[model samples]
Target chain A: MENPYIVEPAAITSIRQETDETKTYTLKFVERERTLQFTPGQFNMISLLGVGEGAFSITSSPLQKDDFEHTIRLVGNLTRAIDRLAQGDIVGVRGPYGTGWPIDSAKGKDIFIIAGGVGLAPLRGLINLIIERRNDFGVVEIMYGSRKPDELVFTSEYDKWRAAPNISLFLTVDEVPEGFEWTHGRGVVTNLLGLSKIDPANALAFVCGPEIMMRFVARSLTIRGLAEENIFVSLERRMECGMAKCGRCMLGRAYICTDGPVFSYPEVRSLPQNLLAASF
Target chain B: MVKSTPRALKLENLNILIDAVSQKYRTYGPVAKDGENAWEEVKADGELSLGCAATMLPAKHILQPVRLDLYSFKSSGGFQIEEPGFDEKIALFGVSPCDVNAILALDRVFGGRFVDPYYWQRRENALIVASNCTESAEESFCTSWDTGPELYSDYDLLITELADGYLLEVGSQRGKVVVNGLNLPGATQEDLKEKASRLDAARAATKKRLPVPPDDLHQLFEERYDHPIWVPNAEVCFSCGNCTFSCPTCFCFDIRDEVKPSRKEGVRNLEWDSCQLLEFAEVAHHANFRRLRIDRFKHRTIHKLSWMKQQYGLTGCVGCGRCVRWCPSWPVRRGRITSLADPVEIIADMLEPPEKVEGVERPGGVIV
Candidate 1:
C-alpha cells in the first residue's frame, strides 16, 4: 500500500551553476536501491522541507541510474529556496511523473529539438538520450536560445553536443549585451528553423519553452509540413499534487501533470480558446 | 445479498433506527446550525432533524474532510513519513437523494485512477442512510438531472418519508445490521405503491430543468466555449468562491505542507480550493493561465457541464442547485434566487440565436 503523498529524501550530491539565474542540482536518492526509472521529458516535484514544492524536469538521462540532475531557475519562492541549498542538503523528491517524450516511438525519424530560455532543461534529457543512442535516430537538430548570452545554460555541454555524430546544434541569444563577446545566431530560437535543413515529412519535433515560443515553433514546424500529431510541446502549469487530483494544472479535459506535460500539437490545439490561446 | 423489499417504520419509531445505528457507529445527521440545515455529529436522538429542506453542505466534509493531514513529519526521524487514517466508524443519517448521487460521483473520482486513501479510510467504514427528497427546494433541479426525489441504490439504507410514516428500504447488509433487533414491520404493497406515486409527483413538481439533454450537453457546451454569455456573467462574479464551496460535486482541492513554529515538525494538509480564484492557475514566475474572470468562469462551467462527463461517465454537476442558491451574485426574484445563477440558464443564453444581438457575430460551432 503506497501513499502517493509521501516524499522520499534525496541528498543534493553536487551543484553546478548553469547561468546567472539557474543552477543544476545533482541528487542521489537515500534509498540506494530505489530506481527512479523516469523517461526523458518527465518532471519531479522537488520539495524544500517547509518551504514548499515545485515541479522540475529531470535533465539527467534515464541511462544514468546513480544520479539525477534537475536544471532549476530561480523564479519563485520554492526555486529560490532550492537554489540556496548547497551540497549535502536534504530535500524531498516525489515523482518521475507525467508523459515523457516519444523516445522509442520517434526512432528512425529526424528529431527536431527546439527550446528557449530555461525551457531547454527538460529537453536536455532527450538530447542526451538521443546522442547516446545516435544510431536509433535520424538527423538530430537542436535549436536553443536564451534571452541574453549570460542566461545560456549548459555552456559546458555545447561542445559535447555539437561533437556528437548526426547532431547539429544551433545556439542563439535573443539580444547581445555590450562588452559581452558572443558569436551565435541572433533573434528567437524559432528563427533558426528557416536556417536548418529538416525534412518535415520524416521529422518529429519536440518543443519546450515559454508558451509563446512553443506556439511559434509549433506553428513553424506545422507550416514546414510536419503533422500536428508529430509535434509535441511540453507545458508548465500550476501543480500541487503530481497526480491529477488537484485541479490547478488542468487544460480542458486533460490534467497536464498526468495526461501530459508533453502533448501533441493537435491535442493542445483542440483545447478551448480560453484554455490555451495566442493572447493567453 | 440483502433484501430489497420495502419495510415500514412508524413516524415515532424513526429514533429507534437512529438509536440502533448509534450503538455501533458515530451518527451524523442534519441539524439546525446558525439558521441553516447542516450535517453535524449527533450526540443524542434529539439532535437529529429529518428536514424536508436540503442541508447547506453535503456529507463530503465527513467522508473527505476539508483539512486533512496526509502525514506528520518530525525532524528526529530519518525523513520518515507517517500516514494517518480515521479511527472511528461513522454512520451518516438522513442524506438527501441528490447528495447520495453526489457521493457516488465522488466515489468514482477518489476511487478511480489513483485511490485516495484519506477519503477511502472514512468512506469504507461509514454507513450511508439516505433519505429521499419529498419536497423540492426553490433552486432544486435534481429531477431534471434524474438524480433525486428517490433513492434507487448506492446507499446502505433508504428512507422515504410517506404521508403516514416512513418506508425503509434496506439496500446493503450493513443497513440490515443497523435495524436488526428493531423488528420493523414489512411494508405492504399499497404502502410501496403509494411511495412510488408520491416520488413521481415530487419529481414532476421540480419545475427547473437543464435546457440541454444529458447526452447532447457535452457537445453543446463544447460549442458554446466562446459564447458572449461569459463576459457579462463573469463581470458580476465577485470570485468569492461560495458557488464552488456549496456545490455538491465540486471536488477541486489543494495540498500543502504546514510546519509548526519550531520548524522541526510539519503536516501535509489537503484543503478544498475553488477554481474560481485568480490564483488557482498561477504557476511559477507569476504566470496565471486563467487570469481573467471569464477564463475562470468558462473553465468551471465547461469542466462541470462537459469535461467531467467525458472523463468520468457522469456529469460533474448533480443539479443539487446549491451553487444557484449560495452564489452571492445569484439574483433574488420573488424572495428566492431564480435561474439567473443557474448553469442551465447560462448555457441557454449562450445557445441563443446570434441574430438577436446587434453586432456580435455568432460563435461558430466547433467539435473536438
Candidate 2:
C-alpha cells in the first residue's frame, strides 16, 4: 500500500488574522504542479516538521483553488507553531481527506448554516461555494455566534455576505464588551431560530461548533420539521490517519475518517457513542 | 496414486533441520521458562519447547509488531517510508494447530479489507511449522469453534511425535519444497495411516467447547442489542486493552506522526490500538460517542459477532480464547459463551476421518 503520510511542501502566501487567536493562511504548493485537490469541508494534516502535526480543515472553497486556505486557531502545540509562522514560510501538507459536505444534494434547498467560534472554518468553505453559485441554491441564512464580539471570525467577509441578494446573515455573541456596540441578535445562536422565515421541510441545515451548540441546533431543527437526515453536522475527532485503516476515529463500526466527519443527526444517534451529549 | 506414507526421523535430525531453517529465516517457536511461556526467535536447536500448551503471546507479533515506524520525514524536504523488510524468511517451529488457525483468522482480517500490505508482505514471506497436541490444556477450546488440536489449512508443515522419532506431514507446496530440500528417510503407507488415525484421536480428546453456536452468533448478539447482560459482564473490565493487544485476530491499529526535535521532520507510525479506550470514538470538540465503559465493552463484542460479519463475511472472533485468558477480570473465562437472549442448544457435528495422507521426507536422508 502507498504510504498516506507523505506530505508535499507548501509556502504560505498570505496570512489573514480572523480573530485574536485564529488566522487564515493561504498556502500555495512550492512545486506549482502539485496543487491540493480537496472537497470544501475536507481537512488536511499540517506539519511544521520539528514542531508537530495537526489536522486543519480546508477553509477555502473547492470551486476556487488557485491556492488553498486553512483557518487555524492557536490552540495546541502544532497550532501555536502555525501561529508563529510568517508569510513565505514552508509547511508540510497531507490529505484533503475525510468526507466533505454533500453540496450536490443540498442544491435547490433552503440552507441554514449555524456556526460557533472556530467551528465555522469548514462551514465557511461551503458558504463560499454556495455564494459563488448563488442562483443554484434557495434562500441562504447564516446564524453565527461567538464567545465575544471580538471573537467573531471573517469580519471582512461579513459585509460581502450581507450585500448579497436573497441571503440573510445574523450574528450573536455571549457578551458584548464595554466599547463594542451590537445591533444583531443576542444570546445564543439557537435563539435566533425564530428569526428564520425559511421552511424547514424544504431546507437543509449545516451546523458546526461546540458539541452543546450543535446538539441544540440539531434538536431545534428537528423539532421545526427538518428530517434527521437533512440536518448535517461536522464532527471533530483526533485523527492520525485520514484513512479508515486507523481505528482512532471510529464511531462504533463506522470510521469517522472514512464514513464521515459529516453525518446526519439520525446516523449519529444510531452510533453507540453519545456525541449529542455536552460531556462525552 | 499410492497413499503417502509417514516416516520417523531421530531427534538429532530434527535439530539439524531447525538449524538449517534458522540459517535462511528468522525461526520462532514456543520456549518455556519455569514461570512463563513465550514465543521467541530461536538462535539454536535447544530452545524449542514442543511440549508447551501455548505461548503467552500469539504469533501475531511476528507479522504485526507492538510498535512499527511506517514512515519518517524531515522538514528539509526529506522523507522515508519503511515497508516490512522480511527478506530473511521466517520459520515458526513448534506452533500448536490452534495457534496456526489463529494465524489463519488474522490472515482473513488483514488480507480481507484494505489489504494491509505491511501484514501481507510479512505473512507471505513467512512459514509455519505446527506441532500436534500430545495433551490438551485446560484453556484449550479450539474444538468448540471447529478449529483445533487436529489441524487446519494454515500450516506449511505438521509434525507429530512418534514412539521412536518425529512424523512429519507436508501440508502445502512450500512444505514440499522444504521437505524435498532436506535429507531424511522415506515413510511407508502404513506409517502415514497411523499418523492420520492418531490425529483424529487427538482431535476427539479435547473435551472443552464454547457453548455458543458459531453460525448463530450474529443473530444472537444482534437481537440482544439492548440486553442487561452487557452491563454486569462489562462492570469488571479495566479498559486496559490487554486482551486486544494480545489477540491473534485483532488487527486494529492507530496511525501517528512522531516529529524530530527540529520540528521539520517526522515519521508516521502504525501502532496497535484498542477499541476499549475512551478516546476511540471521540470526535472534534472533545465529544466521545461511546464514552461509557459499558457501551465500549458491548460495542466490541457486537462488532466481533455481528458488525464485522456484515462487513467482512466472517466472525471477528476466531475463538482463540486469548481474551478470556488475558483479561484481568475474574468473571472472564475462555469458552464462556453468552447469548443476548435464552441460550440455544449446541449440536456437535462429527466429520468422517480421511483415508490417505502424505508424510514429509527430507532430501539426502541424513538422520540428525
Most accurate candidate by DockQ: 1
Across A115-159, the per-residue lDDT of candidate 1 in tens digits comes to 998989999989888888889999999999988988988889989
Candidate with top TM-score is 1
Model 1 DockQ (Cα-based): 0.57
Candidate 2 Cα misplacement greater than 4 A, ranges: A277-280, B1-20, B50-53, B76-88, B94-117, B130-135, B144-147, B158-173, B183-208, B215-235, B252-270, B273-292, B303-305, B331-368
Q: What DockQ does model 2 achieve? A: 0.28
lDDT of 1 at B120: 79
- Compose the digit string of candidate 1's lDDT tens values, residues B75-151: 54246667785687999999888888788778777877678777777889899999888778767878767788777
Q: What is the TM-score of chain A in candidate 2?
A: 0.96
Best by lDDT: 1
TM for chain B in all models? 0.91, 0.80
- TM-scores of the candidates are 0.94, 0.81
Output the TM-score of candidate 2.
0.81
Scored against the true structure, residue A15 in model 2 reaches a CA lDDT of 99
lDDT of 1 at A127: 89
Per-residue lDDT of model 2, residues B168-189, tens digit only: 7776767667666576666556
